[model samples]
Target: MKLQAIFVGLVIVALSLFFLSPKVNSLPVGANVTSNTSSNWSAAIPSRTDAGGTITTMVLDAQSQDDGWKGYVGNISGKFTLDDASGYSIYDWSFTVTEGEVYISRAASPSWSTAICANTTIISNEQNYFGMTAAEYDIINKTFNETIHQSFRVGVVDIVNSSCSSAFTYVNDSKYPYINESTPFQEVLLQTGTDLIYAALLETDNEGFHTGYTYDFQAIVPDNRTNGVTTTYYFWAELGT
Candidate 1:
């Protein structure tokens, strides 16, 4: 009788602990939150594997419920980086929108425009704000306070270490093999369904303006036709140095 009583007590204790665990305390599966000034929005990175590289995505949305699927209405932001074992140097990066009306936002100042298809002027005093050493960025700030982002939708951004030679090499050299060096990085930011949602930003190396080798944005519109279940927004990234 005592043995059976102890076994019953153990089961009750285990059940109590399981229900009180931190995992159970997480945001309910189908809840959605948003933050414009900060990256407090609900986001996730879906895993993927490929020959060229492994790609990951950081997704954000405002879903009515957490059905482990898509947000009813929100945005997707993805960043790419080199796998430590890949042994690669980032020569260029690109952002492609396969579906929905997606826009990109790279500027810190809210006043800066967030148009994806337009060649907008960037007004900021911070040189290489996205990526660079404090001292090096200071030097650039002292030398040329502001620069222009040439009109580009897909292509390479110039490296800071080289005398604009790396951009030419990546664009012209068959070994490196890249396209549209004219497409500026600043122009890659996309616009979303619920205004321009900017989060999941990756700073570049000291020698580069951005850390991410590539960035892709996919905005999935809410599906009203379904039985209140929205499809997940797809955000993908291909990592390289």
Candidate 2:
């Protein structure tokens, strides 16, 4: 695989809350609903070509208020225009997301490191695999002349009834347990031949498989000294794996 580098930065609002007082009438099952938030974020990915456009995202967590039909949708979607971008190229993109949540008494930082990985194979097999190690992150930071937070990891948890049938049946296929920064930062490696990004970033499923059980993605990074200060630039995107 050929690796070409282009630096693109994104600002995302993480851990923001929307105050929605429960209504007398609940949202209908399977009905698309949006949160009452005014926050908007923009991110960009450099393509094989030099020209670029805008990538916008609205972050929210939505679900039906029914007990029997409980579901999760990490309501994150992006719009982009990579000029004549070929599907077979690797993109070096960097994104920022606020690292803490606001509360009544005090703000709490993320308990784990979080990332969003693009399951490219779901759209095209020519694009395969996404990988990033601490070493690579170091290089990207130095190359871009930037300082990014190195903390916890956002892992793809097991979904009980993933819309992907095969994935639903074998929910525990990946042996990786959700770990925090006190433990070493393990690398993220997903290959087209074995895994797919179901719905949320940091999630993976058996190659050539998918499910309907969509969800929001997050990791537990805590407010500890050894872990460094929490900040934006807490997210990453990998094209293939």
Candidate 3:
């Protein structure tokens, strides 16, 4: 009985040591050091659209600071017209891109459209001119630079539009009426330890018929990869009036 008790005690001590031993280290040395190295990044060729009455295309342009990755960092331009005679307004835009690359995208207009109108009392349900007053201006302006930018992942090469409600803003709020957009700075950081292509598309619905309201759609790519290598990709935009 004493021998059995001694054996049990030994087993307990062995198990305790096994459980309490220090863990082995496995990460590479200086993995947290920062370096600024220039790379050979290029912008994908841009496609033009005239469906919105005015078509504008801006190249994705970027510069590497201390060897950082660079490409496009602003809005791609597009336009459409609206007339009050018709109840429904339709605008379509699309961009073609390489499959398997990650990207962050968003849509934004100038502060003029986003600003509140001077007359807050002008309100109506069937013809809410107050809500659409800026849209009216957008039609008259014919075209403006509204940018949607996204970051360092890959998505399949395909067409994206505002009709794809998942990819766009669907609300009537004054802040973002036309498209849903995000930047790569937010998306890529969230997706650490993964490699893939990403792309984004944006669009808006026509509330009324106006002769010259236009929306300009653009996509931008900003690589956030730590390793210094120039990445190349392409995207195309098509406007559906």
Candidate 4:
């Protein structure tokens, strides 16, 4: 009876430690702008447009609210902006990313712009965004000592003019590969961290006026677990240029 009692006590103590341990601080998922301003234009690029507009930068804080055992586990919070440089209020954006976790961004054309143009081409596409996974991201941090994956997303917004349409496309060596036609909202999973990611305003096949638009980018990080220890999940984004 005494031996059985000691075993039960040990089991209770082990369970307590498992539930009371501090989680590791893993690298956050999603895009986070450490600092942002108009003066920092090296990383910002102009978009092809007919309206002659300029690009503006802003930051947003993104967070996720899904609870699961493993899929899509992390908070997406960061700063990104609107790059409107094409004369027509259209802009292109890009980012260099590292591998750590899967990330996603959401874009939308607000209700206020419905009257501005009904036939606008405001769709979320992926062909404009680029990504590549790097070997450096495989390094295990002593703090967490777990593997991470890096990913990014490009969102499209406010393309409502029937004559004008926008899309996300992937370009390879200056040649267009894939194009996305869905507007205002789209999502992509970036598994590779070796290449640069870009977002651009697509031209209409029929040749028409380019309408105004807006978009947001986000990065996603996955939960980290090892040896029965799990890290607190977080999403972050870093801006360049």
Best by TM-score: 3
* Predicted candidate 2 versus true structure: per-residue lDDT over 1-241, tens digit per residue: 1233234444465876535744322111121235532222344543344336856554655533211111122323322222222433233343332221101001122222232332333323312112222353222112222111222222332222211211111123232243332111122222222222222222332221114433223222112122233322123222222
Which lDDT tens digits does candidate 4 get at residues 20-127? 445432222254435432211133344545455767564755543322112221222322233223424233444332222222223222122121211111111221
Q: Write the per-residue lDDT of candidate 3 for residues 1-241, one digit (tens) a residue.
A: 9988888865534343325545432111111113333334475666655677666666766643422223332233333323123535454344332212223321111121111111212111101321233444322111112323332211121223221112221222223433334411111111112212223332342221122432222222333334544444433332322
lDDT of 2 at 94: 38
Model 1 off-target regions past 4 Å? Answer: 1-123, 126-176, 181-241
Segments of candidate 2 deviating more than 4 angstroms: 1-73, 84-216, 225-233, 239-241
Q: Model-by-model lDDT, in order?
A: 0.26, 0.25, 0.28, 0.26
C-alpha RMSD of candidate 4: 24.5
Query: Candidate 1's residue-wise lDDT over 152-195, tens digit each?
Result: 22122222211111111111112223334332222132232223
Q: Clash number for every model?
A: 16, 23, 59, 59
TM-score of 4: 0.18
- Model 4 alpha-carbon drift over 4 Å, by segment: 1-15, 19-30, 39-97, 100-241
